[model samples]
Target: MTPSVERVAAAAGAWLDQAQRPMVLGLCGSQGSGKSTLANALKAQLEKDGRRAAILSLDDLYLGRSARAALARGVHPLFATRGVPGTHDAARGIALLDAIRAGQPVILPRFDKARDEPAPQGDEVPGRIDLLIFEGWCVGARAQDDAALACPVNALERDEDPDGIWRGHVNALLAGPYADLFARIDRLALLAAPGFAVVRGWRGQQEDELRARVSRGEAQGTQVMDEAGLDRFVQHYERLTRHILAEMPGCADLVLNLAPDRSLKEKP
Candidate 1:
């Protein structure tokens, strides 16, 4: 429905036409930045021509709370705190991707936010598929060095003393076992909001609405972060996003700026 989203879908569909094999498109953005919506819209474009498209959110690969706790004790404890590279089961995720591309029925993992755990047994199915839409706040957002977090977040710094700390273990995960696989990105589309303040505001409102959904039991184990809480959470993402926000202008194949009314503007 959104023109910006429609543009991204159209671009992706055209790019995949020349692929010798299934193309893996990465939709990267922060939470509430509309990554999933774009993914669905892109799939629609692919399906319109009777082409095959499959979507797999990196969010679904989040490591369980217990595993995260252990990673913190051993790897980076701070990573266990929230979304980051170490938060996902990269091995399983990579294998799943391979399965989907092979066109075998595959059952992906499901993460439960309430219980903070993954389904004991993953979805049972085949591993066959076509275009794999892997999306998330940190989908294609790369890992950053520890020195990157030395500086405080820009918006927070502008407001006052920007003392919030966002450390990255993403660099760790990327350089680790998943390094080679992550490099296979056929294309990456990043949705960049104007500023962290705007991103935080949008995220806060989105979470509040999601909480209402949870209250109504419309969804199970949904994520809910409040204004105060999101402030803290954004600090974590900000440390890692400095590079993303900076590189978005030049790096993303397509960049969309979202208006307050959810209107799309192509970033030139």
Candidate 2:
């Protein structure tokens, strides 16, 4: 692990030491902000210390492509995209967390983003987990007021969703089920990027890595996005990303600000 990962994980481990039973840690950040990497590192460190930990990603709980397509047909076209609030299976996520807390064995769902569908059920996790690390791009985001939704944040919104229907629907999801799911977190941490502009570059780097894997015949059936596609794809997340960047630091229990190059600006 890099020194930054080690430092962040060590601090998380220390926090877990004093935390209460059945601890749930929420790691929130914008796309490609290293939330998943940090969650894995924290889980590894905790396990080494003899603590049984499980990592759950919100991405894994996203609605399948067919379901999203149905939603798009019924609600708004933008619902077809997986990154927004309404696109996740929030009820299932709540039930999983409830089962984990109730001491029932649970199999975490895994989503294959490359294939745009849910993967097979993952290995069963013991219900009596000592720690659960839940990570997502908008894990701790709250809904915006009606007045705030009036403005378009980007070309996608300005052009495709001129009436604000899509964003309004997403904001409603955040206010309801998403809020309930996030409330399960005992402590929250944010891996904050310098600003929204850095997200496209970081996300582009991830696409390059994915492309490399595909070229090596390691990632078959993965639908990797090109530069133009990636730009449009990220537009789905731009508004909420900016919202979280503005508000999360003040509310999160811990905040690790990241540099433009994706290095830790300071130890958590």
Candidate 3:
């Protein structure tokens, strides 16, 4: 097994062993930061250990294109892109998580990237889970004390702006809709990397692969972030990305660095 995967699994095992309640291990990272890759590895490891493991993904909570478009009309235009905090149905997500944690069956939303929205909402975890590795693109990201958390400020509100001020709407979402669920996490793991620059190229490769799949009708036409679009897309993730790398080390019991090649290194 990969070192990062092994390490993640060990952490999950420890949480399951120690916590009297159901264990929720939060794995948070950027788009190409390898959170999903690590979660899959850990899931395999847990199953091998004869423990029921579930990967509860936030991507599955994505709203339909129509819903996202409606949200963007009132908030920042970036929300329509589907990477921002408002793109998810946070209330439903919290309810589903709570139900699962309370030992009840819950259906998860099925997401289709090619269609650029959530598919049917009938997706459900098939079995009881001893441990849940819940993860998201912007998961475990905090916006407090960061200038980038501002919202309705248009996508151009950056350091170069004349006022250099950011609004608080986006941060409010982090503090509001997402906060309650964040409180339920038992442990967090982060994969540190350089900065948004690293994500541009990686996201480009992802979009290229996605575009080809879309052409064959095998994948939905999820928004494509090409060279320039990716640069812009990275901007939306920058502020939260900074917090995830900066704060997650202190908050997470384990931090791993994943290279572009998917090779691993432990955070020093």
Best by TM-score: 2
Ranking by TM-score: 2, 3, 1
- Clash list (residue pairs), candidate 2: none
Task: Arrange candidates, best lDDT first.
Answer: 2, 3, 1
Cα error, residue 53 of model 1, in Å, equals: 1.2
TM-score of each: 0.84, 0.95, 0.87
Provide the lowest-lDDT 10-residue window in model 2.
3-12
- What tens-digit string does per-residue lDDT give for candidate 3 at 1-268? 8788887888788778886755677888777777887888888999999887778788888878899888767765556777767788888878877876776666767787767767766657765678778888777766576544433233545533224332356677788888876777778787777665577666677778788877887765455555776666667666667667767778777777777665686445
Global lDDT for candidate 2?
0.87
Candidate whose lDDT is highest: 2
Against the hidden true structure, what lDDT does model 3 obtain?
A: 0.72
Query: How many clashing pairs does model 3 include?
Result: 4
lDDT of 1 by residue, 59-171 (tens): 78888888889877775446566576778888887787776655667887777766777867665545444588888776666555666645655564334333422243456
* Residue 105 displacement (Å), model 1: 3.5
lDDT of model 2 at position 259? 92
Which 10-residue window in model 3 sums to the lowest lDDT? Answer: 159-168
